[model samples]
Target: MLPLAAGPPFGPEHTMILEQAATALTLARLTSSPAWDRRAHSSVLLDLLHWRYRSRTEARLRAEALGLPTTGHRLVPVVVDHPGAPSADGVALTDHLASELLSSGVKALVGDLAEGRSGLLLALARASAWQPVVERIARELRAAFGPDVVVAVGPGVTELGQVTRSFREAEEVADAIGPASRDRPFHVASDIGLPELLYSLRDDVRLQKYVEQQLGRLVQHDARHGSDLLDTLRAYLDAAGNKSIAAKHVGLSRQAFYQRLHTIERLLGTDLESGAQRTQLHVAVTALESLGPPAELG
Candidate 1:
């Protein structure tokens, strides 16, 4: 089995960790006997991941209280979230996630965040291959919760004092990634991309107007004529302005594809091959997708 992280702790416990985690989730869900239990059945994770403790002794005490095995390793903070305040079902889901991680011998603690989010503190004994571990857990999370659940994995910290910073990193990743499907359910702080940036800008009205302006012409063309120039433009841009590749993707010869590209350029009044125009279209397309299908394309 791969080590939880890349460094020292590797082997023996790797394969069964995910299975154990799944079992833990199942057991936790079964024990969800109460509804709307806001008492934070597990809040030590909040203290561990939010604020710094005055001393190592204090941190250790809190970790122990949360059933985290923090003696020989520094814990990695992982945060998962869904939209809106968590209902009883959501809480049960979070509890199951925490339990599964702990059961997998992950030396972890689980707690509910103020909103509809959950925090986890995991002890990975100096292992450097933690990315795979996070990815594995993420797959399980997506499978269990569908596409809406997002997992943000923080960098590993060797000291208790640094854990809150790691948690903060996880928080940023979770926010940037937003609600996701299983194909891309989790991300790290370092992986923030244009899509994530667009997601964060979803509330800005100006952003919406900007998207409408950039691609509105083609959208309207498609609506009016049953044409697919908008989709063709999307493919062209996505292909990085490579004519041959985009042509092949759109199932057209180079000549036909060039004609379509020319038509799109005339319609949009922008050079498809120009980097500036491509960037604008890219952002607009990303924004449109993020905002959901427009009520009126134009």
Candidate 2:
């Protein structure tokens, strides 16, 4: 309730004016509350993640308003996906994660990403500090959400405009890990070995061409005849050219595996015993697995 003016000169009009002013004040207070601030932070973070600003000046201004670093800081994009979580509210999950990070002395801006998924922009004083920070985030998220939560940490960038690249890398890491991420819930893009190199070139036409050049005939044969020739080749290569071991792994007798290997060599026009050809095919196979299905190449 508003205090009435002294001297009894107030009328109904004055009361109405006071009431309107009080309503405005209440709205202003509401907008400045912590929940509202979280929403604002999320909005700015989504803009950053999507590179929605028209110019760096505009982006910097918005980030500055939210106390987010735009210069003299490195930002690492981290994506978290919890498929087993009970709730599908991404915004609420992000808000909870952001609050937890804040309490742990970590500065992060959170945004919703698909259902049950969240994106975070972690502010770092140095890019080298990302590993520890990401580990801490993974630990916290696992403790809060569950062990099934997947966390993918991308490379750190110094500019706000470059955050989109980091976010995309993180997203790719998450996708590449897929449902097989339970054994290792936390993955950093830079440290994921060969897949990281392949993922970096996922958009290159040459990468797809190389896979086609090396294994296209085998893949086509498998699709046409509904054969396991491609799987046979992979098993053979994975076993380091040991035909017997590869045969056992694929549940085939040595003679049956040899027949498939012979067919593979004939179709691919390469000797399975050539070290150079084996290395080349191995790389192509790795590219196919890392970058997803060969059908996606077309």
Candidate 3:
């Protein structure tokens, strides 16, 4: 509330000014409250994650208002996905995570992405510092949410608009690991290697065409004959072109494995002995695996 002083000369204009001043005061009080602060943080963080702003100037202004550095800093996006039911106090989870990050002396903006998924943008003075900071965040999340949680860290970016790319990479990394994350709860985008490249291009028609061009004949053969030639090929390639090792992996005698290899060569019209051909086939096989149904995280 705002108090006003007036003399006999005061008119209706003065009354209007008083009302506006009181409204402004009320608004200031509301925006300064803790609840409003959390909402603002979440809103701005979501905007950054999705690249929602109209211009770089707009993004920098909003982030600067939140005390996030827009320059001289790199940001790494980390996503924690829990497939279980929400915690009893799920509404407060964002605040809890933010407090934990603060306690560890890490500067971050945290927000709840969904019922069981959370996103964090960690601002670092140096890009190399991301590893230790992400490791610390993983430990904190595991300690709080148990080992079933999947924590994925994406590549770092220097500009705020690039954050959306990092966020998506983190989500894709999480999707790639899926339920297998139970054994290894933490994953970094760089550590995922070839699959990371495949994931980025997983939806391209060219990638699917490449896979079909390399393995279509063999796949058709297996489907029509109920043969395990594809599996044999995978085992063979995994054994680094060593026939004895590949034979043992598929549980076949040397002669039988040789026959299967010959069959594969005839169907695909490619020689497995050529290192270049082997590399192409190996990549195609990996692409096929990556194209399979994505695993659900739990």
Which of the numbered candidates is closest to the native, going by highest lDDT?
A: 2
Residue 163, candidate 3: how far off, in angstroms?
Answer: 5.9
lDDT, residue 210, model 3? 90
The lDDT per prediction is 0.72, 0.76, 0.76
Model 1 spans with C-alpha error above 4 angstroms: 1-42, 47-60, 69-71, 82-91, 127-129, 178-186, 253-256, 294-298
Off by over 4 Å in 2: 1-35, 43-91, 102-105, 112-118, 123-133, 139-150, 154-183, 199-205, 290-298
lDDT of 2 at 74: 85
Off by over 4 Å in 3: 1-38, 49-61, 64-76, 80-96, 102-105, 112-117, 123-130, 142-189, 293-298
- Locate the minimum summed-lDDT window of 10 residues in model 2: 176-185
How high is the lDDT of residue 199 in model 1? 80
Clashes of each: 8, 0, 0
> Compared with the true structure, what per-residue lDDT tens digits does model 3 show for residues 146-179?
7777888888889888898888889888766643
lDDT of the structure predicted as candidate 1: 0.72
lDDT of 2 by residue, 94-124 (tens): 6678777778777667767767677888887
Q: What is the C-alpha RMSD of each candidate to the true structure, in Å?
A: 12.8, 9.7, 7.7
**Candidate that would win on TM-score:** 1
